[model samples]
Target: MITYQLSKPVEHGGHTYQNLSFRAPETGDLIAAEQFKGQISQTVAMLAMMSDVPLPAFKRVPLRELYQIMELTKDFLGNALATTGD
Candidate 1:
């Protein structure tokens, strides 16, 4: 398991946020990016569903789209890590 810590509080609108974090489990031999992406996407989708938000109309969701989402997630994680570097 890969764990990262926040060095500073996340702030918005002049207020500090707490407990904001991300975690990714590293498998034994393979870092399957697609699997991570799918996990994130499904989690988001589930949250949206719980909140009664309508999902987008995609004729066919492809693996490429999932990969793209994963890449975006990786970039986001990288930025967060950089901001809270040790």
Candidate 2:
């Protein structure tokens, strides 16, 4: 597992939430997420799946916020990959 402090938080239904904790995704995770195929919603969905937080909470996140969240996920995963050599 790897944790990162989110520079930005995601809000949904008047609730604010963030996950600084995530699991290193497996190759299967990549294959599972591939159906999203460059779509932001699916990318966010993948990040939510990787996070320690409950995935349903992110379902309501605004589309505008997904890019930033995706960037954070990318950075976290990249750093995780570098450190773990997985």
lDDT of 2 by residue, 28-83 (tens): 65555555545554465567778745456766555555555566568545543332
Whole-model alpha-carbon lDDT for candidate 1: 0.33
Winning candidate number (lDDT)? 2
Model 1 lDDT at residue 24: 40
Off by over 4 Å in 1: 1-41, 44-53, 56-59, 77-86
Q: What are the runs in model 2 whose C-alpha is more than 4 Å off?
A: 1-20, 63-65, 76-86
For candidate 2, the per-residue lDDT at 14 reads: 67
| Model 1, C-alpha of 8: deviation from truth (Å) | 41
Best by TM-score: 2
Candidate 1 differs from the real structure by a C-alpha RMSD in angstroms, to one decimal, of: 14.3
TM-scores of the models, in the order given: 0.24, 0.49
* Model 1 Cα lDDT, one tens digit per residue, 2-57: 22223444444454433223234233212322222454454334322322223341
Q: Can you list the residue pairs that collide in candidate 1?
A: none
